[model samples]
Target: MSKLACAAEAGMLPGMFKRVVVFWALLVGAGWSAGLPLSPKEVVVVYNANQPDSKKLAEVYRDARNIPQDHLIGLELSAEQDISYDEYQKTLVAPLRKTFDDRAWWKRSKNPEGLIIPVQNEIRVVVLMRGVPLRIKPSPLPEGVKVDPKDPIGGRTESAVDSELAIFGIDGLPVQGALKNQYFQSKKSIREANLPFLMLTARIDAASESTCERMIQDAVEAEKTGLWGRAYIDIANKFPQGDNWLEAIAKKNLEIGIPTVVDRFNDTLPLNYPMTDASIYYGWYDWNVSGPFLNGKFYFKKGAVAIHLHSFSAEQLRNPSKNWSAGLLERGAAVTVGNVYEPYLHLTHWFDVLHDRLLDGNSWVEACWMAMPVTSWQGVVLGDPLYRPFLHLNGDGKMLAEDKDYLLLRSAAMRWGNDPEEFNKQLGMAAERLKSGTVSEALGLDLLAAGKDTQAAVWFRNAKEHFEKAEDKLRQDLHLIAIDRKAGRKAAAVQEIREAQARYGPMPEAKALAGWLDILEPPAPPKALPK
Candidate 1:
């Protein structure tokens, strides 16, 4: 059995409780309103007053997300991405908190001694616009402060600015090795909806201000059009922990019926294999994944979520057209999760959890925060917090006529949409292979390549329903969900998951489908008000 099997068997997995109470609690709008993603109005934008471009970038983002002008807070700070801990406390954390307090952004109360208790914070997300520093080098502990035994590195440490925001108020507290995320997987811990907002921050920074501006625009478009495309997962067989996490991610994608390609090798996918229409990507352990996709000219679908796991992968994002996170942004990915400093192996975000939660319909911020084990550490979430990729997969999973996936697929495969001869050739080829059940799938592929995706989707389904064996048919059904996603027919794909569950009985994949279906379901009706 795999580690996941053991965990599930032991019932130690997060949110595994089958009880009604647990389910209902989790079902509550855990940080989201019904039919809405995280609102831009709830976000505060931070920029470095020291950099003119930073202010300009903030303005562009505000326009894109409709963030209020008052939400933009410019602080006098260094242009560099790395800073000392003292500098962070003095310049970024302390000053920002003071501004929030003075502006009455949220309510706080004080005791007789007059120490304020942060009762309610309205700002759920802090959007670090371009030019803000990315990390803080660990400062030495104060005299008489004992070292945390958890510091396997013997007191040396560093922190990501986004991570430290989880504990933005605890600036003067004694330094520990790292702060474990208390709400890491707590279904009830999403205090954003009813209580004070804490943790959860995203940054918009890249090689250039224009790139940052473009990211904001792309995210808005993706949310409007839907996040429908392929997923590419690459794993470097290095440490067991990292490898296991990546493998789990691929496995979960397969279980959730996402169209996916996984490459487990020392190297990444070669440049020649087309990676067009990719909406999701995760790869790791190396400083960077070398591939054609890295070039600024390569662009994924508008709402693509891409991340390369590496120490210091997010160390800088000022060059909108180059290096790590910024490079991905320049190349058109909307979301990038990375580290700003050496987080060591155990402190990084778990890719498996990230995948599962996103599929569960959690917005990017909620999903990222839930998966991250520690805050006040090295991880940084870079994207729009309210972007929910799976929101497109709701209801009957039927593809909407307006879904961008249809257009994206048409653009990539069907020159037939442009050329009549290509359309005729596909029609001719599809007819020839329809006679052989085993070869019928090839016909669908040919049609899909010619951009006759609706016809191709029908053929693929027929191959599964009529020609494929039980096990093979089940797999095909899952793959068809990917096709459904690409064609913007998520309602049909969701129905496929239901049919598959009935056919397979209580299998692992079936159970995963049930869980995902819950995520796709609308929030439970609000409890009746008190009589």
Candidate 2:
């Protein structure tokens, strides 16, 4: 059947199906879940056509993500950190607009002449490459134009490149200043977001090119094991709003089911605190790395995500040896977000929104973009835009110890496959411990990862047979689907999903997995539109 026909059969409009797919891709971040993997079809990579390094970086990302060649858009722009408003419009904006139109990505409406006029909503995100201008210089006031008294930045001027891209669909030059993010605090998944004026924007940026590449790789790897570390939030003696925001985020962290450590009364995470195994860390009001940082004594887990709020926190994302952003990345964080310039406390990332959104299952890029009040200002999200942190919530409750043990199987599987000498030694150990479905499932994943599909399938079937509860059975079945997909058995994966759904009948996991598969693996392509 055609893709549109499949949408119709699924009881959704074609546009709604696309939106649902986009929404699912953005929200489904974590391990062995029902949603689609982030696809190249949903991405558009923008590069400075004039810069060799920018082209090189864009190509690397595109190749890594399998982004379609047509999805790549380039513009000739100056190699400067900032540009005037006119220059922004003439160079970046105009070219971007033209590219979207040519690609049939920009929304269109029928005019009085019965012609299509560009509107909005073609793409979910625009990834600005390394060479693009990072900020826009404010235009001089013409003939005594008065600024809004309520404006925070002494007359709402200048804009960040990624932020301005959020408002790219606005008609004429946007002089009304920074656009407000409607999605803020809504905590809606991207599929549920009511975005009309702006498309989400992220950039593959850092102080250096190698750092940018590593950031992307880390995001992908982190998504594999899922976000399995700790959340450390440190707040000093607070300002009313700042304190409120910090407290709310701390509350949100607990609410979202992450193992969170909230240090509210202290100036920082106490120096003596054992701050190891951090997956997500947020601390603020420090001018530089503080006591909580522990002078490199702590070890951040692979794909760790951390952020520290300070004026120049992002001054050098490339320098791992430094005190701020780079230091966090160097110390092994998969992602870190902060401002490029001195964004006063209020203007920086809203802790509440950022935390809540991540818990709600938005990717790092989407969460950061949605939480930021002013995109054209200073806040910059640095990481893989596709990184989804909370994809493995097993029915609202945290993953049980058994479930965590299943996660450890990834390492065991690696050892089993890589160390042939140890495999024989481990075989005896597995015979004793592989009596349960959990261990069997881990073995299944290990074998699957090692390209042993037939053996993996046998282990998965064994897990299903040994399941103690309907819930356990359903969880293993869902996991089997992920394994099948990875093992190049998508057809078998669908069969497993359908069979589980039929047996389980409307369980949340079953329904979500079914819905995600329906949207992700559409029946077939409709005509020649982009995949």
Best by TM-score: 1
Model 2: per-residue Cα lDDT at residue 329: 69
Model 1 misplaced stretches (Cα beyond 4 Å): 1-36, 108-117, 148-150, 192-197, 294-297, 319-323, 395-531
Task: Tell me the tens digit of each residue's lDDT in model 1 across 94-212.
Answer: 88889888988777666355555456776777888778888887777767867668657446557787888766854244454677776576443255344363647888867776676
lDDT of 2 at 202: 79
What lDDT score belongs to each candidate, Candidate 1 first?
A: 0.64, 0.63
Q: In candidate 2, which residue ranges exceed 4 Å CA deviation?
A: 1-39, 108-120, 148-151, 191-196, 255-257, 270-274, 292-299, 315-323, 342-347, 395-531
Q: What is the lDDT of residue 48 in candidate 2?
A: 89
